[model samples]
Target: MKMVDTMCNMHLHNYKDILEIRRNTSDFMWCSRELNLTKSYRQYHDLTDPYKFQYDVFRSTDIQRLIEEVSKCNNCSNEEVSKHVVEILKEIGHTRQMAVFRCFGLCFIKVLKEVISCVFVNEAQILKLKSEMGGNPVIFVPSHRSYADFLLMSYITFHYNIEIPCIAAGMDFQSMRVIGKILRDCSAFFMRRSFVDDQLYRSVFKKYVQHLVTYGDAPIEFFIEGTRSRSAKALVPKFGLLNMLVEPFFNGDVPDIYFVPVSFSYECVLEESLFAYEMLGIPKPKESTSGLIKALKIMDEKYGNVHATFSEPISFRKYLTQTLSATLDFTKRDSVEESGHCFHLAYQIVDCQQKNMVLNTFNILAMVLTNHLMVNSLEPLLIDHVSKDVVWLSAVLKTQGAVVQPISHGTAVSVLMESIKVHQSLIRVSASGTISLVKLNNDKCKTLDPQTLRGHKLSTDMMNLAVPMLTLQLYVNPCLHFLINSAIITVIMQQVGANSHINKNSLFMKFVFVRELFAHEFVFYRPVETQEFEDALTKLELLSIIESEPLRLGNHQKLQALFCNLLYPFFSGYLSVCRFLLTADNLEWEERQFLKSAQERIEEELISGWLLQPYCLSLDMISSCIAALTSMIVLSKIRRGSQVHYKVDKDRLIPVISHLESLFYLPQKYQTRDQDSLEDTESIQVISSSEPLQRLVSKL
Candidate 1:
């Protein structure tokens, strides 16, 4: 729980302090000095000649098998297959040179001092993991946030004096000239992004990874999310790489494997700007040496602290045993069944990573500040107001069993001010000591209202908001999974009053309904578990927000306000998208066509002052909402030749939009009386109209 300062002013001399903290803390146990490498690993690397080891054992059998498989197709000669195998080996294989690793380790530490303020590790869990590593292959499955993730894993291991892992990097990096070679020298192996039709390459790559797990002694490291999370939330796990890494244990080639779910939290993501553009449907630039050289200029700027936390090791043998017990004859299962098992395992790892994520001071502050902007408009938020909200949020998170960063209420404002300063474009402070959102540049702004010259394009506002809010959203995204249950309960309680005799079955059904509505808007690991729903109910009862006997609820005014703030972005975004969809000229349209049309209409609405929060214009989230509508039969899918089209059912969608709008719109009384009223109060107007459906249809 203590912070480690690795600043350069200290001469990079914090090792003694780290060691002392480890000694005092019961959670961390240092590894034995004599056991740097396992006996088998030592024996393998101790050969007098490097070529002898390579000739006898470096994926020879797998390469032969791949060559034979390729030769069977008669697609190429034996010599060609052999040459392909050689190229694949060079691409996927790692050279574990201790001297090279040490050199890179020192260089990484020095470079990190310039780029980041500090690097924090969860020492106790890491030490425990190291202690348990000798019996099985150890795998580190970290959430991929940046290119920095790959180096961070190796850096931490080397810092701890443990054997460095062989990292699985994308083939994009392998093409980066000197950087690629240096990465390989530092024990990184590359894999193609997709391997659908290339069976020869697939076999070679798969066998290369298997050889590492089964025979190589170093721990294996890979991203379970498969790639960086573009939206900064945990993505549904990608099973391709996880399946290959775990296959050794399933095939009995290795006794067992231990997976350590690692979570990383950064104060400032290096690629935040690029990720924002990608979210707007722009293609990400490919990795290149020139790009690397250009990026080096930013090295002079400071990116804040990063925290890496490791969770308890998950035993693969035990998990498989438990999972297969019901099958009765797992060994007789087909490839499909095996794939299913791998998918289940992938989900389990994702869940583990989610739970391991530590909500730091920066993310919590971002959540409070973002919500403030959403409810209060772009006006300057009082410093005291932001600080008060942060305290409230931190308390709420702690009660829900989340790991909140330890910051006193008095210090919360300072922390928030620091975070805002890091991303200067997000917020601007006035001379009067109030904070306001920085508007987008005039060149980037598009006129939504041609007549008045006041209309702004949705993309313009989105781009402007993306500068500050997108990065803020990244910090807030991790906590959404934790807050969703409470959010649902609060929304339900508000809808169904304390005087009503609510049916438990009906209540749970409604909860599920709301959960599915925003499934795409939020990163839920899976469907809401029954136990979680029950727990939420119990929590409500304890807080007197609801009663169990008659299933009644309480007023809980403060709780309602808190929940409303938390869910505003998602609920508002969904409602806005649905409203835009209803304006389409044709009901039946292909998905891509629908999205393009929706984007245009949304921008038009933004110009017309129909949408309030520009950050809500997420294309992916809009698509997810459409899919959810499809699932609920509010939108029907129609097949037009080879294309899939959607037909919106206005009859069903009207009530859905009304209910969500009610949840999203904040009451005028909720705001401080002194604050100016928002000009774009169109949402309130829509909800208050007696014939809402008729009004919406006429406007369209």
Candidate 2:
């Protein structure tokens, strides 16, 4: 674990040959990510799907029989579900390699704090957090970046000698061959897609999650956004699992609920190269057997410790109050609270890591410089850069006593920064060290307020297309747009004594930037012919883009993120005018071009002319919607280069607000059947005969 200035009798730049010597001398050692396990994995019975976790012990066994015999049940037997899982796991052969259940069950049984310290860079931070929490179920909900989350969580819980809770995964991969067995073993159950007509499945999932939380058997894990975002920036939370995660808390069995928002960080992502290809208008590929192989080799034994830090928990009362407020404002509770918690926690822990962990000056320089290098607005950032940015940053953070270790010199800084610049999400790194941002979050990062001022300005194209930069990414804006504009368009049309049928069929189109002000000339999303779709998608697959069809409402499941990108601008433009500005007439031609693209390519979508669509809802109502959106960003002082962008003056903006007041402001249309018992059930008692569950309570 110690660093040395020289290699064993080696000259400079002999690292490659040294690697060869190590490979030849030590069988356990590996370099260039090669595990030399192709032979073992090729063993016909060694079926392993890296995309999903599949556990053998859970499959081909009577886990349900054991549970039922011990606990008893009134509903349909789990025998059938167990059978499905076993069958799938055996077929895919992926069940044997996963460590999820082993990690969870073992941690629950052993409760060793050493396991945690051994695998994390920020162990002390967590220890302090644990002492503060003093025992409650702390939910670790993070942005879903990869399947690695399973390992990261498992390792954290294992190291701390605590039991991490079961997670809820989609039926698609979680229930698929081999992967399903691993998930079930890890206490993960299948969650049905929202569009599925099966209410029974959803109910079962809700009840299962509730059982886990109410009994305090394990802490629960969930992804706020539901799925991994295509772009790297976090996406808004999808409510599919939120209601269930909180169900136990609402029932009152637990006195308090503490939500531990965790931020998962990695020096190098397993899926980076794969995701880069996806930004070039290619269809993304699914995690196939080969991809799984790569993932397993990389994961089964990566030397670097994964970092998972827990924030202070919140009581159930606070969560419930915040939840209600969020639902009312059409804002997410986790969004308001967790974002702050994670961001602050990440910076603090990362700062701690620099000083306490073995991070040298190289890492510090690389981390900051690479980040600065990615900034599109160089003038502003460079002014910060040439002034010895990281040095100043370390000094500023130190003024508040943040633990940022100093670097050796500017040389170490430049090398590390160059290395980081070589590795950026969605951004292409050229041989010459020139860089361009790529859209890594895919459609998930599509924001409503993105380039609001830029509109169709070609120079701001990167902001419009890729995951938003810290300076450019607007997390709260897209939800605001969707809530205020798309959903309300129909409601407003119905209220104003307009066409009722028109309202039902309309939905908004997602936007894409064809020509933008800031986009590099080398970066672009090209339209592919039908024959090229498969190939392009293959390349996208190689790029590791997370592309899930969020809403497959069409008779034909032909929706693409690109298509969404193409259509959203018009709808956003329309909504802006209605909600923020009086009109779009004052905006220049660049602002109008965004609408022009939507109009010209409108027919590309299957729902182009269909009634009840977000775009074509009226007067061709879609145009009016775009007009409203355009005005919001365009006419607002934000776009006018005023001292404060989007500054709302009550009297001046009230009229702008009044024009679109009805957006997302609707009466409760359907009452939830399970609203009465939002917390733990009264009938349940939380009892632990195990060490892990006992630890979870003590820590929470």
Candidate 3:
């Protein structure tokens, strides 16, 4: 990728830098004084005031009227309603004291600096957004990737002189004792994970959020995804909080709300281990103050650099005006209709978040390195291959409209080396100077079935590799979404061959099909416009990756190989799941049970060296693939006694599996046709069929 000049020079700050900056700047006292001087602020200056205000809003005459109207059928009393209001407030409210906010902000900056090297990218966009903030309530919707995400947004705004936002935080942190209280004081409002059945809490929380947007001067911040993404890519958005935040704009309480989508890319995530466990179907540990303290013990380790890119602000008023051409009259709508409208708006916001995500050097490097590792080709040609792939990826990202760091051919190795050092524990260099992943030596690996240990007889070595590869997959995950369309087209071209009459509609259908198949493996936002496939094909032709006239194609054998390599894991995992479903005696199985069995089966495949696609070991992706299959009618779902069970349809199942299996075979020029047999092939095979698959078997 050609490096372009960024608005601000990248700022790299060490842990001690925070202390030095704190000592040099005495603005804390001034900030505290400013906090004390304002009357409205004073009224809510105590740590408990915001919570009380939320209760007041809930108990307001309007809310009481609505509650009475909604609950009259049940003969609920005013006292009972009042009691419910208190419970709702306790669950959803938070207090913000300027003094406490300032203190925590300082400490947060210090702790963040100590733990990770933070880099703020696209500052020019942030400056522009900041200048445009005053007329409307600004909402900062950053992609959530790790626990550190909570602090990064606040730190960036404070560093740039913007007011710290009133953040919406999950109730998971509410139990963190002193930390929880401090977070509340620092402008974080705790929210229940789900309020589906709690109408009272939902109503109260909605009003509280609306109050903030209408009155609060500071910007409002919350993750569009709702929670930290376990897979490290943007999750399908949870619309509840987003709907609540945007309601004020539609209600005409606020003239407009500007949403700033921020994307955070990490060289190494603080919650990598936890996320890995969660992906393996292991339940995450509950959040607690003691756990937080224990986690702090490992703060001294290096976490490399974190890049936060702020995309251009999106106006909610303008968006709604465009989406809903008619004047909106929220007053005329029922609760259900209003919710449906809000969900539609939430989807638009999610799209903005997805587009705003910038792929940086760290993630790109991880992807390139991980692909090489998966193929066992990193040893002899590690530096050379990584360098070439990085350059290729840079150009590809640039073409895809991502803001990649300027990487010269000379510096690519150094950049990758830095990444290796940052994730040193997961990757290692042997005495022979060959690179390999650290093997799992834990009790967890020991208990795994021997059939799952493919190449290694011992469980420890198997796990060491499996665990690190899974973590590496997290870093690689985000990049896949960007490359999916191109990958689909490239793979199809290789299958259909050059000089063949390729039907555009058929190709588009195939693109959609492959995209859906890997939906769980990669989280991608489906574009509203149908032109994405056409656009990708057009670009590929322009780049000579494919030819339009006579439908000839370029020799993208190397490129096609890389794309196949990236997809191998998902295909293998899906194959394993399908195989398991085929053999299992139970025609119908609960979702959780099926997922557990699929994971165990994949692990066994990995251990027995039967599955060469390391990335396929993820239980999250397996579960998602199963859901996708059900949607495709390859699997039928039956709800029995409150539990959903799935039964595979043999007819639908065969075609879908065949299509996925075909993706593993590259064009002939890209492989050796004489490869011993299908059994000897590692991850993918060379297609030798006479149909479309045989078209490209000839030498380049």
Candidate 4:
């Protein structure tokens, strides 16, 4: 395997490169019973007393002052407000006990070994980060991909003798009966999904977070993405918790606050099936102890390796002085804080997270298969073609600075076969030696109720095809960040004519428009657009895919097709919204009603052969399109009581739709077939691989 740069901190480069020196263990050893069971008891443990911590946070001057201030504002007695604050603290606080921590560590290890082959972490970098943990508070902002993410970090810290961070968890887990109390004992603090209207709760939560930051004994951990990304893409960072985190540094409570962006990449997530169903308009099952027991059946299966990378630690103090140039005035007590500064800093952490993401073989292989299925839907992919395309795509991603795992020399097919074996629940190879996606059981959702769906209800026919296809696309979504910019250029040039010349100015204009159009769908560091654009051009030039001087096209036809086809579904999904808006020029619909209308309209288009991509059946993308349109002012939003309604401004929408339509065109071969293929969902089923490497399936 080829090694990539694992360290992101410049100062840490002076240390000996340990990541390069450490040899990767075999998959068998990664899942070994002894490895998972072993523990180092002699390590220093600086665990905080949860009871004292809570009392400290409650009695802190910040919380007391805020409580008094809120009581005065509400014209209430201080005692009443104090009682309310105490109740709020109990709801949100964590209770960390060393006994529970050690006991849970063992249980988590057993659970983890059952499902995952390995958890690959850079020890040297983690030790370096641990050394820098003193004198100020630290925040570990890891990307959220799975429920397992919450457990992994705490386990790692315990193994490495570092203090376990007090994690911010959603209230969904807080109601999971005994499991909730256990998690709290393991240092997981619960917070509501949204407390925007509850001033007392919001103030208490902020003060609780600020107290955690100010104490400087234990690290505070939270998902900068705020929630698990169903699509597995880096979400636009949430500002509520982030604003609270940095407030201390702005007010001189801490000299510096360190923000570490940790990226977790899974070969396959435990929630793959659930996320797939949820994306196809089915509501996610609520978190509960009963549900937890039901999910234990998945422990019999094997999810491949996971890579957790700790990127460079960002100092708020340094960033304020260097990046923002003291744009935030700390002296002005009455000055309002602009969200733009927070946004810049948040995106910076997200960018680091993306950069440090470790792409497994399955990620690249899935993308190759998705690209193939776009052109030849009925055909199975040959092993040779799969191997070649995997190599080609891996090279493409590496050139763009993506951290793709290297294909072993001359063993690409075997490596890919192993990946397919690990993810056999998702894809399969036949006795004929050709690979295809495994069809989701059509009868699985027969008992599903329509009214319970979180989004528009779809027919069983759509669900059969949409579920597995979207699941396949979920693996492909992580690679989108590396491909989106260049792919946009490819589509633009394809519109102008593949071999035609276009000025840089004209290409950039189209690029900016499309970027803004999908702003809600993907993460784009808005402050650095010019630099991102220039970097995309440079990457394309380095790959010999395009020319820089006067902006001419290159001869890399296969690479161009890869880019074009990879992003085609997204454009198709977004275009459907534009076409829908064109028809409903003056019509107004409530926000939920608008989304349902758009989804139903798109389904009709897909079935009637007007739209081709089945992957475009994403409710997330449909909602993201509406959000983008509203932000762009192509659709005007108005409030009526508790409901929000949208009206399309045809004048502004026409040009936008025209531009979208200009960039989008589907060839006949790539389009969907007639409605006859939709008669029975069973016809979509394909045979599983011969013998299917079931050795890994039944027993690791």
Candidate 5:
């Protein structure tokens, strides 16, 4: 087996548009009577039938062993639990029928061609991965961005002659009428969104996932994030599937397992508008056949390009010995060490996904526009000015380790114009050559019934900017992975005046506080406070904004301002949550009630001009703030039946609220000293790092 280093370096120029070759193939041979329909195809020779794999799972020794253990725990007869296990295997299993797969592929190909301009992939990476196949189970862990992720992997593997992976899909898709069975036949296995209450089902799922890893020939694909990131950012990974996938290797059932990290970048996301509505208080529409049919309207529009990059396959055995085994004992399955192993592995995959991401030109444009809006929301951006900013920002991001779409594709002006044409709905260039946001009608938001609202109902005034601003934020999100560290440092510097020389130890504590405060807003590898601080300092130095030895801000005011603007909206939202908690007359409130009222409070602040960013009126941010506060023990939850209520700990929260307030009140120009307020850091809640880290990890 071939092994690539743990940190795989992805070259932006290496990817080729796989669709280019597909479009050149003879239509007759590509569609009907293709290689997939032929008996001598690679899949036929190299892979076991998925139905046979399911049959083996149903009767596997692992399932039988689990049944015995579950029966003993539940005080049920072996026969009863055995019957339940069998029923579960039937429900959770997938069958890959070639005929149905080929039929769907044919139709999907046409849709892809009509809607998307190109599908870029690193053919060399796929070929390298193909060589690493067959000795052990291969787990394909992709970052989920859109529903298109499910189909993109299979499409690429089939085109490359690799066996299509049996995907772990949500049960929501299982009810999509004709699409459900077709998806199953194309190798999709359904699982409920959650099964923590159903012990029998949980046991079955664990054993079933292990069965696939231990015995199935094809690769197994699942999302590390567990769901589509409506914010277009990476989410904290869930460990349930990672645990199950690695159990076989620990049990000695398989020699080893391979974990592959896959990333998908869309120039223009198909569900961009829907995701924007979801960011506000609008409820997501259910996945139904009607919804799927209605979504076909996207075919008439352009979704510029979709880039898929596969990182090096990580060797489970080697990773265990070289990384986790140092501190964890693989012998104890339920021990804290075992939990740490799962989390480290999950974080590694998510990190790799971010490392290999391909940033589109629009991602850069979005960031520039967002910052521009911060200075002047209503003014139209001139094409020449935006082009210059895009070029400068692209260079800045590249230096900070981002793989931006090469400017060699065209001049910055032409590239910017082309990207605007692709996203004409969200942003537009008028005949007079001024670019501005396309706003959603206020009447559209006014018609939503209160019960149908996902969270708080926004006032018509707030609703005017809600959709466009949120959607623009979504585009800006993909760039956060590169900018997050520097942004954090910038906010810290802004808090303490530019001339202040602070102790590195004291600075790191504040860094920890800010990082944890937004833990739910961003995805990060935990238990690495020291490493993250050093990296942020390194990145800040790389950007020439700070000197690392004594940690002093540089004289580059423009660059510092960019970093500050990038994170202002999120900090504004969190500050609003903290302020709401500080002033609430009631000490305790239900969780659901808190989210609505907090958002309402923010809406009022927006109207009164106390809030700086309109996009800060977000339920998601408010909910994340509540989670962060709860994890920190600044707020404690009380469970009443199915609903959970929170009680504020004013003592712990006052410091947090004061700390956030002081940062904003500092000189915005990053110059002058707030000597008295600098002393207030003595009161900011001191976190003994590890306890809060473990608490948050345990909650996840």
Candidate 6:
């Protein structure tokens, strides 16, 4: 393996060094000869380091100050513009290598000669698109699906004889040790996750993009949901990059910057089926080298082929996503927060739960096909059963005459069973041998807690649920229900104790406070009614975040672990900060799943609560519970603006009061019910109590 790799790598260096050099350049531009002038360079060094060559070539030139010099130009001096141009060129170069590798695997370079000799200009129109790529270094924004997107696009650019374009990828890729080091040496730039929040980093990265945009060949590019869409659709556009593009337009710094929407259709994505299964909560370990070899062997035993289509471009930056909001017929008001993430163009590829794959004919078909099978009593069906909603998917495959083996109900079921055995998803014995797709949390996620500032490693089962609705094609409706159920945690919280006397009117004020949020976060959608969503108060009461619970559960109960994991979503913005009424045996697996998926929704709601003050009454019992809910000891402290020290009880509550006068309760007409701690204990056995305050805590 090492010998083959070394020989292949050496071969890769010889054929593509100049082009490779261009890819590695930060600001330098070169004629083919300047790039191809490696005879002396290679011989002088007696070695090949893509990075060393890149830095040496560029540093040897005057490109370091290229941007500074360009910025001095009144005719064309936008730092942002220049950076994008340079970045695009490099992105193109790196993408080419990746593209070849995808097709030829580890032997890409070894097979390159044959492929180039045989494969003619695949698409002439694609080859001559630069003239049409108008302004702002035209960037092709396509929905993300598999990691193979980078390669497919690069191949198209190189085949078309177009100039290599630089690509912008996340820093995570650059962190892959030697591979990352080599990629950085190529044109791929390092972008930190924090760059999304910290504008300074964004500015620097944006400036780099602008520079690249002005320097390279049509700077071929696509931002995969800004990062990589995990769900099978174009996720929300990270307007941050879009905003940078818009800067030139708004300032008249450059001519029109065109944004062409490219629709990519894949018959079989290298990562499609597995990635889909994974994101759908399937527990398959990543295909290791040996596993990949095994899969390849299987592919050879069957048939392997791929077909892709590049849709006509959609341009009109003036009518970008923000300008054209999609109005789905169904309303998921509870998932307004997740909806925001959906709208942002940038994405992060974590576990299947965190990322969304790009949507295409295959995924759409997969979903329709899976649902048809799952609904038909878990009997997998043929593509013949594909639904009209996802029919375009079939068309995409049929047009290319796909080589995939026909899947009958029996065969499909068999394969699905095999997938489950490998842990791509799970099969539960509940409901007489029901299959539920689930991904177990790995060690990295199992030990985390978003609540503990230092313990961000998520508990496994809970993390499993927080992942987005990647299998949207299969359980779109069920997913919606699950989200709706999870969303209720905060939505109906203000009214948890129906008979409680915490002023009803004021209670309404402490809810939803909906704002920009993703739909898949906290809003779990289930196909049917679920108690986890239905029993909001019971969960909250148990969480001890609400002072209503008489006795908190022993931390070791299965319920406590479940609640902690599920509630992480609530705290982390899946559900808005609210209380769940937790109690003994309050939820089953169905309920737990609903609770787990509510993180994004809860987080968004928490934001709204912060901005809108969802905790309407200063005396909200839940807030007090939140103060004392953790295993940490509850402490007495002075209110932000008050003088007297307020003490919190074991349920983690501090008495909330309103000053009616300079020295009296604020609501002078309000009556006070002075009851002892023991007096309110009776409310536990019954669902409700008569006292106004007690009722509010118990039933109201």
**Clash totals in order:** 2, 83, 12, 0, 0, 130
Give per-model TM-scores: 0.81, 0.42, 0.84, 0.88, 0.90, 0.41
Better of 5 and 6 by lDDT: 5
The full ranking of all candidates by lDDT, starting with the best, is 5, 4, 1, 3, 2, 6
Off by over 4 Å in 5: 1-7, 31-52, 65-80, 326-336, 377-380, 408-410, 548-550, 665-700
In candidate 4, where is summed lDDT lowest over 10 consecutive residues? 675-684
Q: After superposition, how far is residue 546 of candidate 1 from its true place, in Å?
A: 3.7
Q: How do the residues 1-700 of candidate 4 rate in per-residue lDDT, one tens digit apiece?
A: 0112233642212223222221343333322323221111111333256666677778888788987898899999999998988888999998876667666666666677677776778667778777666767878889999988878888677656667778999999999999999899877898999999998799889888887777646677899998899988888889889999888877787778888888888898889888888877788888999999998998899998887888767877677556655465665534435435577778888888888788878999888777656553445567876786677678778777788887853889899999999889878888887887776557756787767765677777667767777888889999988889988887787677646789999999999999999898999866678777888888877765677666876655456556777877888889888888788744687887776777888777766656655677788888788889999998888999999998888889889888988998562122222212211111122222122212111111
Clash-forming residue pairs, model 5? none
345-374 in candidate 3: lDDT tens per residue?
A: 555555555555555566776776665555
lDDT (Cα, tens digit) per residue for candidate 1, span 1-700 = 1111111111112212232333244321222123355321332454333334344443477667667767878777878878767766776777766666666655555567677766777776666667666778888889888888888887778656667778898889889988888888787888888887788778778877787787777788999878898677787677787878877776777777888778777777888777765555445777899998898866776787777777766777666566544343434546435546666666666766666566766677677666555443434567767666666667667666666666666686787777667766555666776765565453333533333221123455345554455556777778876777877877776667546767889888777768778765655534335777887887766655567777875544555555656666567678777887676567676777666666666555544545544455556666778878987899898888878888888889888887776555542113332212111111111122122222211111
How far is 43's C-alpha from truth in model 5 (Å)? 13
**Model 1 misplaced stretches (Cα beyond 4 Å):** 1-66, 323-340, 377-380, 440-462, 497-501, 525-528, 578-593, 626-700
Rank list by TM-score = 5, 4, 3, 1, 2, 6
- Superposed Cα RMSD, model 1: 8.2
lDDT of 1 at 146: 84
lDDT of each: 0.65, 0.35, 0.65, 0.75, 0.77, 0.33
lDDT of 2: 0.35
Judging by lDDT against the true structure, name the best candidate.
5
lDDT per residue for candidate 6 within 1-700, as digits (tens), equals 0000000111111222112332345321222222211010012222233333333324422354554554565355556745653553343223234333233422432232222212221132343345455334556554455565665555545434454445566665654655554454434555555555543335445654554443333353646356443333333345455545434433344444444344343333344344433433334544344454555432322112222333333333333333234442113433432443223222211111111112223343334333322122224332223222233322322222222223333344443333234323322222334434443444545443444321122334333333322332322221222123223333333223333333323332332222112222322222112323224444445433233333222222222222222222223221122222221132221222323333233323323322111111111112322333221233344444423332333243121111101111000010113211111211111111122221111110
RMSD of 6: 19.6
Whole-model alpha-carbon lDDT for candidate 6: 0.33
